[model samples]
Target: MVVLNAVIEAAGLEKTYPARDRGGTPFRAVAGIGLRVERGEAFGFLGPNGAGKSSTMRMLGGVSAPTAGTLRILGLDPAAHGRRVRARLGVVPQDDSLDVHLTVRENLLVYGRYFGLSRKAVRERAGELLEFARLTEKADERVEHLSGGMRRRLTIARALINDPEILLLDEPTTGLDPQARHVLWDRLFRLKQDGVTLILTTHYMDEAEQLCDRLVIMDKGLIADEGSPRELIERHITREVLELRFPPGEHEQVAVKLGRDGLPEPERLEVLPDRLLWYAEDGETALARATAAGVQPITALVRRATLEDVFLRLTGRSLTD
Candidate 1:
């Protein structure tokens, strides 16, 4: 079993970049963030695009120095002991930067060499990683010949060449199909079971729910909220959600009417292009009340609360937005 000691700690972390124009104005990508990640816990940084998730991950991975504040990874300063800290960390960036000219196994071997591993060790590790990543069958195939999911898995395997104590993944399954995503998730789950500390950034709420033990929601360079998926959902949203679809032009009128007089002014309300979301503590009761109040919807659905509801309630925007 993995120990529960804090492996990563950051206090008042900040990162600001100069503006693109001649004005030299500063753009704060991350601001005053404090976090502690325990060893073997799967922690997630969740936010929409441009919400500083990537920036925070970069700083914690020791690839980018924070503009201010202190960070310690494995009790070592990330800025001062970057090389040493990196040796014990695995990083899988959003973009697959594998060498297309090299075969799958070759890519792993080359990255191992960069870490100063001897040829014999690299070869043995490559074989093991290929099996772990399920790419053993394609070991001799060039990266360019592999599918997107294959390439992504290869990148993940390459990151583990050093047997890192920490694994950092940025959008691990961003563009994969459902089947491919499940395969990746299975691999990640296995790693978690093997006592690997994982830190990831993802826009997919379901992914976070499935993998993270806890997560921070970021917006506009600051953390909006932090908790486990279930905790956040319970705190920020109701137990059930009712979705309704009205006829095309009737949405606005329906929304207005609902806002003016709905079932006890639901916990939260959202009007979408073709539907409306009525969040309430009890879905059946709310639906009954709405129906009794002469509000008729073309279609309706009642579902359990989810992390997406929490994110929307907190940020006032969809995760994709």
Candidate 2:
């Protein structure tokens, strides 16, 4: 690992919440996970709902202490120095926990005071953050009067009140519209360019591809894989994948016949209810050979392999699944 002043480091980090029922085993939200994030890198935890992404993020945010293992953020132990750690870290939660009664700028000013900023200082920072979130026009509007996207942006701007060194985002774009998500992405890109270390959790493959410098894919409370999006895709799958769709019932039958022919057999073949994915170094070659053998697909498409394919290959389930 090319360590450029590691800002976040963990060894066997774990978290467990109390069981809901009496005598039941405690719920293990985050199983042992080891990670290292260098300064100024946009790191991410990519996973589906209930895959321990939130639990792990909570631990990193210093709001919840880990049950076991070790963690260090900015060279300080989060479990021990949570207050100091939080002072230098921004957090945009999955939910927009804005005070409905407060104006866009008032909310930020209030949060900034938690870090002990003077009223005048808080006001100044709130002004800058309002501009950053593109909420200058709505600065005096009550949060309840703002649109969903505007509220989300305000939440992010509020988290920056302390001028934190690192930012933690949990499913930042979960409910936003496409335009809102893109807008958030652009803001996050600027933060990355400004040398602020960021850690975010997301189930969106494209989001990870666009924003993360490095990431870990979590599943069932465990680290399934870790790498840059392209690195993970290349490591776990072929360069190209051919998607062949037929009538619902014919997938298994054709899949059997395709492999039986031994005509440049697919490097990997995935049989799905509606389609068959053929992995190959060259998708065109695979498609032509299949066509020559009278294995006609109702519809065929060839595309580059993606992180989504890597997830499916690793967990036997896609993000939606």
Question: In TM-score terms, which candidate is top?
Answer: 2
Segments in model 1 whose C-alpha atoms lie over 4 Å from true places? 1-3, 259-266
The residue-by-residue lDDT of candidate 1 on 1-321, one tens digit each, is 655699999999999987889977989999889999999999999899999999999998899999999999999998889999999999999998999999999999999999999999999999999999999999999999999899999999999999999999999999999999999999999999999999999999899999999999988889999999989988888899999898887877876776645446447677777788889988887788769768899998999988888888888888876
Tell me the tens digit of each residue's lDDT in model 2 across 211-254. Answer: 99899999999999999998998888999999999988998898
The Cα local distance difference test for each model comes to 0.91, 0.91
Count of clashes in candidate 2: 0
The predictions' CA RMSDs to the true structure, in order, are 1.8, 1.8
Error of 2 at 179 (Å): 1.1
